[model samples]
Target: MMSYQKFARDVGFIGIVQILTSLSSFFLLPIITKTLGAYDYGLWAQINITVSLISSLALMGLSMSFVRFLSSETDQNKIQEAVYSILFFVTVSGFLASFILYIFAEPLATFGFKDPEATYFVQAGSLLILVSVVESISLFYFRIFRQIEKYSYFTFFETFGKLLIILILLKMGYGLIGVIAATLIVQGIIFLITLIIIISQIGFIIPRFTYIREYLQFSLPLTPNSLIRWVTESSDRYMVTYFLGLGSVGVYSAACSVGNLIQFFVSPLQLILFPELSKLFDHNKMDEVRIYMSHSLRYFLIIAIPAVFGLSALAKPLLSVLTTQDFISGWFVIPIIALAGLMAGIFQIFVNTMFLIKETKPATYINIVAAVTNVLLNLILIPIPSIGILGAAFSTLVSYCLMAAFCVHISLKHFKLDFYYLDIAKSILSSMAMYFFVSSFTISGILELFEAAGVGTIVYLIAMFLIGGFTDHEVSLMKKYLFRSKVNPSTK
Candidate 1:
């Protein structure tokens, strides 16, 4: 059994890693925007969107299947069987998908970029599909095995390497093609390194196709889920490009990236929670699962609520410093999209119930409904000329809210999770207080922005304390673990 202290420590470590990974992107955004300009940046966004969609399709949901099937298994032969089965399938599918993308690059560019000359970018991005699939499967192996440190190391290396390469290529005046090539090269190198490490650790055995049927049975239902999720998350960028042009897409993408910082906190919890919960459920330890579920939701809100409030409070100033004036209007969508991201995080937690029960069809269905709603709403709202990208943001928020609500309703029918409404209320109140406090300050530059964040964090913590956000027992446990106390604190 994993102790609370150990779990907390793992979550904290991974959270820190995720924050650094996010910071890499945060740091790169300004340079990317300034170097490529709005139209080309939007084209960059479109290329990535295409890659993400193709990669998701090629994955066929096997990554999650790997976690579900292998998280608790101990048989080495069986592990190898599953591993090679997934690798073979993903490799074939990824390459085939990449080839198709490359062959149709012109049409895709015509449709997505409206400039056939940009076909080369699409073709270059196609190479990323195969390398990305390999990287994702390797990372999933790390995750299922609970190799958190290794996972963090490889992820950091990949992000930093890509950043460095892109910087060099951009400085050499390689432009958009330079950025795409950098991603492909960096990911390919990382894939090779990760595959070697995995083989060395597990020892090579020729893959048998024994688990193919089972893996496919488990994964196929999830393919639509992946596609619909893409629609909900990314279709807006395409719509913006179509209606308002690529510059609008660039601005919207930048804003959405800023708002997605909420994921920095929520994603680490997600990374840890799935395997832990899967193991617990496999052992039929429903009580521990319940505890983990409740605490995870409460803790996510504790961090995410304050973050959304803080980011929203400082949106304008933050955008001014991070993006060019051409993209500053993107700030209008940040608050809306940030809240939407929080709701999306909540939906992730709720959907875990479906996974634990091995009932993912409901999740796919829920997302289908949400994705359709998002697309329709965007269609109606974006053409208003007054609403454009803001309409897209609103559509995302509404769709995510619906997704969360539906997932909660469906999941509750199978199992009960303590929603901890009171704790959530406390978090909201604390965030509101932080927002009020931070908004009182006038932020003009990077230093002032940092000061606002520091002050807001302190104020939010105090408010949470005053409102009884943390239990006495949790406080003691935190102190003991943080200070490395030798005392054996009660885990109850």
Candidate 2:
């Protein structure tokens, strides 16, 4: 079985980096929002999401397939061939996708954004789509080669780079298009930097086209599955745009920004989990895999529930610091979206199990079902006067919860394993206790942040104990870590 303590340690590191990135992003958003205004901010969100969708097509599911291959296969030569093949495919696909998006930039910008000036912004954003694809390819290569330190470096640089450029452009009074252009410029630099790092580590010669062609037989099948996932995840933005306008999208985007902090938890966990889980499967260690998966589910719920609740409770003040006061109107959307994050976390942990078992079509069907549900819900609800953006948030949470439930059900059917439901139940109870404690009092701005946080921790711990989530053994470990104290041999 995977060592629970060591797993937690790795998760802790991932969490730290993700938290730092999210914290920096939180500060960065307000600067952009204040400089750009809601309409312009909404345009940026639209273009970014549009570019993301196109880039997903360019990726063609190679990154995920790469990790899966790397984990399952021990043949060094085969691994090298697969790596080179995916790299070639992504690079070629990136160019093609960028070119196509550029050709249709005008129509996309006009229909994509609520503002007329968004067309000017779209031309600049075309560069972002191009650079973004390159960056994604580079990131996947980084992870496959185990260049995590460099991955962290690129992540921080790419994030801060946009903030720096945005500040420079805003200072020059270049307005909205300037802000969009700044992001593209920063992304290009990051892409170049990533390429330099990868080439230095693994030589610059392109692999033979024949090698990538062979790998495509395996990778291409996953593209539809990936697209379904993206549709479920991103279609809401489009629906919001169609129904509510760009300005409403701006508010929703801001709320999602807060909610994405929870994704920070998921992203890094996936980075560590996928390769490890794949290796475990290859070795036929079903027991170990079950244990690891169970721990991950419980751990994520333990962290995500309280984290989302705290974020939701403190949303107004958090937004005050993250963006401007005007942006605070969307604060209520934070909780709904944060709940979606929690559901997504569960889905992330379980969804790969189906793939591990090679139930690809079933997994695809589940995702497609969820995406269709999200789209239909948005179409029906976005027109309702009082529901608009709030309806979108609710739809995401409901769909995600269903998706997670379906994946878990499929996993149970395939694996003769117990999920430790009692542990999960206890974690839920603890989370609810923490949430009520934090949400009861209202103080304005960042001051209330500490107030809620302090109480939340105390309540969470007490509830965890009361709910019997921890054993004496686990409690002993906590003491050793938190207090640096050695426990005496127990008198049994």
For residues 46-96, write the lDDT of model 2, one tens digit per residue: 888787887777877677777776655656566556666676677778878
The digit string of per-residue lDDT tens for model 1 on 173-198 reads 99999999899888888888888988
Clashes of each: 0, 0
Best by lDDT: 1
Residue 297 in model 1: lDDT: 86
Candidate 1 regions with alpha-carbon error over 4 angstroms: 477-492
lDDT for 308 in candidate 2 is: 82
Q: After superposition, how far is residue 176 of candidate 2 from its true place, in Å?
A: 3.5
Q: Candidate 2: which stretches are off by over 4 Å?
A: 1-6, 72-79, 114-116, 145-147, 447-451, 465-467, 487-492
